[model samples]
Target: MARIKPQALLLQSKKKKAPSGVSVPTIIVYILIVAVMVFSLFSTYKYWSRRSILQTQDGISNRKFIERKKSDIPNYALISTSKGQITVELYKDGSPDIVNEFIDFSQKGHFKGMQFTRVVKNFVIQGSKIENSEATEDWTSRGKHYSQLNTSLKHEAFMLGTSKATHEGGGFDLFITTAPIPDLNDKINIFGRVIKGEDVVQEIEEVDTDDHYRPKTPVQINEVTLKHKT
Candidate 1:
């Protein structure tokens, strides 16, 4: 204690300066840990913010997708006949009411298996009406005459025309005008027209018929199919 050696003095001084709990290296490690925790919090906040933004963008995208899908529906029809087939382009733009009614009748298969019963030379071959006169008579006996509510649409050649009803009831009847009769245009409702299959119409018109104007062999309508164009 009175006179210590240099090496011993150095060791004693080191011992005396030793920390009670933590060392310098431990303090540096604690500072590094705090920095890492702060950085982790900042990264988590940024990630959350980005995720929220993405979610909002996805919602907007989904809304637009649904709106576009709703507006994409088309209106048209495909009528299949035994005499080849007829592609009818509906005139909803000019005749919405008649077109709607025609679509309804077509979809219900009301026009299926009907004959081209009334074929006038150089004129329309009428269909979509009951071929059995007995059935029509029965309907008449019941005080019902099939009549369609009149629409503002006019008759045009190759266009669909409905029959006027004189009695209480009206059934589905359609005719295609053979030639452009401008005088007859305003008298009837023309809902659709033949885009193809005019040859079929010509074939039907050429068939032989009896005095009652009935074809010797009926030209049957196999089916009427409705379709929307893309």
Candidate 2:
């Protein structure tokens, strides 16, 4: 082999130093790949941050939703009479104040052993504040005061009715109508209606009654059991 001149060697070295077409394209691809990777990382971080914020908001909303659901349900009153057990479905939608009061009284067992002293034949059977006028120490000793009566609840057939005498003396008495009495729907607090065992009401109404419309033979409410629907 012949030795190359210095000038020729320098020229060959310069040609080699210049990037090839393939090399230039490969560099461009690498830069694009690096940019995509960086963009992907930024997008992932932003998505996670937004998801965390949404989770926090959902937590608070979930708690409020549960509380509202709890407040919406109205407790049922299952009154066992001498004829048969009558189940009444109370309405808490129209009268929250009355419903709460009734539930509180029921929970305290204020209705146990209360007689159905007033049974209007073919109309309604009323009871609740028997002790209020019975003069029994046990009856008088019980709490008689309830919150101010809202005169909005009315007496309808099968609908529950609260006595409308005066404040602090009306929470204990209640009545159930046997027919559709819409006129009384808004005038009194009709909490609920008999969902079952209304036949027992007809039997009680047929019983012998005194001039005051009270059943000659005492018909007592054996127990009033409050329950919820399954």
Local accuracy of candidate 1 as per-residue lDDT tens digits, 1-230: 58878999999899899567878898999999999999999999999999999999999999999776533423666666777887788877787667777777777887888888766554456785654343434433322211221333343457667765421345777777665544455445777788888877777777887655567987878887877871
lDDT (Cα) of model 2: 0.69
Candidates in order, TM-scores: namely 0.55, 0.57
lDDT of 1: 0.68
Q: Please, what are the lDDT tens digits per residue for candidate 2 over residues 151-195?
A: 344434567768555546445677776554434544356777787
After superposing candidate 2 on the true structure, give the runs of residues whose Cα lies further than 4 Å from its correct spot.
Answer: 1-74, 131-156, 167-170
For every candidate in turn, the CA RMSD to the true structure comes to 11.3, 10.9
Model 1 segments more than 4 A misplaced: 1-74, 131-156, 166-170
The all-Cα superposition gives candidate 2 an RMSD in Å to the true structure of 10.9
